[model samples]
Each structure stands twice: as structure tokens, then as C-alpha cells.
Target: MSRWRRLWSVPLLVLTLCVAGCAITVPSDPQGTLDRARGGELRAGASASGELVTVDGSDVGGSLAGIVEEFADSIDAKVVWTVGSEEDLVDGLEGGDLDLAIGGMTDATPWSQSVGVTRGYAGVPGARGPVVVLLPMGENAWQAAIEAYLDREVTR
Candidate 1:
């Protein structure tokens, strides 16, 4: 093969390898959100809405709380629910006091820009807009898992 042909072939092979789904795995952090939540408690800070985060402490209804309960059960982790305002929930999640925060969060919520927030979900009744969840910033795995679960549960 000509020198130019060999050089071009090398680049092509490299591109092909990159495109072909090379199994690159970055080990999960032992202390990351998912790991921590699984190993310990799944702390959730939720603001009291009509029923989403009921102050009555009844598990009979509400979208956000129901989903959280399911998640806690799925992971076999205990849930410590803190019913408070949005600021309180966000602060808890940011301070690592909580793994997830749920309220009547909408797309216009200021927290969306600061930390990780879930997509708007229409899982609750009497909601003015779609609800979202506040998460620790850059917690990709945790966010993805939450999103997937919500999609599966809420859609059904």
C-alpha cells in the first residue's frame, strides 16, 4: 500500500472503532447519589402541596410522594420524608441531607438552572403545571434512574 493509503487507513480504522460501540465503563462512585441512596436511606425533601406531599402523612395518594414511596421500595431503602417549602427541599438536597426533593416544581422554577432537575411530569391532579424534582447538581446516574422510573411508573 502507498504511504498515503496506509496513513488514511489508520485514521479510518480509528474512526470505525470509536463509532462501533467500544465498551468504555467508568466505575460508579462508591459514595455517589445512587450508591449512597441504595446503601443507606433515600432521604426525600418534599414541599407540601394539595396531596403530593401531604402533611397528614398518609400514603394513600399524591403523585410525587407516591413515586418516592415506590422508589424507596424498589431500592429496598427506607425513606425519610421532610415536608417543607421549595427552598427547604432544595437546601436539603444541596447539603447532602437529602437525595431527592419534590414539590410543585415547574419549568420556570429557579432551581432548575442551579441544580439538577427532572423533566416536567404530569403525574398529579389539580396541578397548575407539570411537576419536577430537584436533585444534586451533576448527579447524572441518579437523575437518569429517577427519570426512567418516573417514566415507567407515571406513564402507566
Candidate 2:
């Protein structure tokens, strides 16, 4: 193999091994939120600070919006959007009124300390910065499923 390819493999291997070493234990309930989301609704919050989360006619158009739509499609859930200020959205997520919060959240964003943040994704256009979604701060099965989907959809 080329030297460049060989060099990349070690770090990739280490990362894979590290990820494999840690496992999340999902509860065994089939009717839990994670499982129910398969054909249920996803309550989501978004700040009306930018185009990334909007009430633009009939569509919510933005990088994070796209991610939300994709997540909803994956689990057969429809996004129930609540547009408001960042504080309001974050409050909603904390209060169990929102399953996901989408905005221009990024690495080093203050929300990371207050809420559960997904791994940042840099691929999407119109992201003010590397974007991460907010979930409640816990290891619930629902958050795990959404994080897994984002690891594939955004990180990949």
C-alpha cells in the first residue's frame, strides 16, 4: 500500500477500536421512545435566528433542517417544529417538550455544557460553523439511535 494509505490506516484502526471498546446499553423495552419513534412523531425545536431553522412557507430549509428531515425519515417520524429563540428551544429540550433542537450549534458552543450535543458535522452548507444537534443530557435509547444515525449521515 502507499505510504499515505498506510499512515491513515493506523489512526482509523485506533479510532475504530476505541469506539468498539465502549458500548451503550439500550433498554429492552420495545415500546420505549426509541422504538416508538419508528412510526411516531419527533418533537423538535429550532431558533428562528437564521435560515437554518425557519418557517419558510411550507418548508423548513437549512442545513440542520435537512438533518432533522433525514432523521425523521429514517425513523418514520414527522418533525413537529417549534420555532423560537435559542433560550426557549434549549429550555424546551430540557423540559422534554422537544426531542431535538436544531440551529447553528457548533463545537465550543455554550449549549454543549448545558445540553447533549451530537458530534459536529462540517459537511453541510449554510452551517454558520460545524453544526451539532442538541438532545437531552442522558444515555437514553432514543438519543443513542439519533446519534448513531448522525454518525453515519453527518460524520461519514
Across residues 1-156, which tens digit of lDDT does each residue of candidate 2 receive? 999999999999999988886763433323355665578988888765466666665456676787788989988998888877778888987777777787777776798777778777776666656777787766367767887887787752
* Candidate lDDT values, in order: 0.76, 0.74
Clashes of each: 0, 0
Candidate 2 clashing pairs, residues 3+ apart or interchain: none
Ten contiguous residues with the weakest lDDT in model 1: 22-31
TM-score of 1: 0.79
Best by lDDT: 1
Q: Model 2, poorest ten-residue lDDT window? A: 24-33
- Candidate 2 CA-lDDT value: 0.74
Model 2 regions more than 4 Å off: 1-32, 49-51, 57-59
Q: Provide the TM-score for each candidate, comma-separated.
A: 0.79, 0.72
What's the C-alpha lDDT at position 28 in model 2? 37
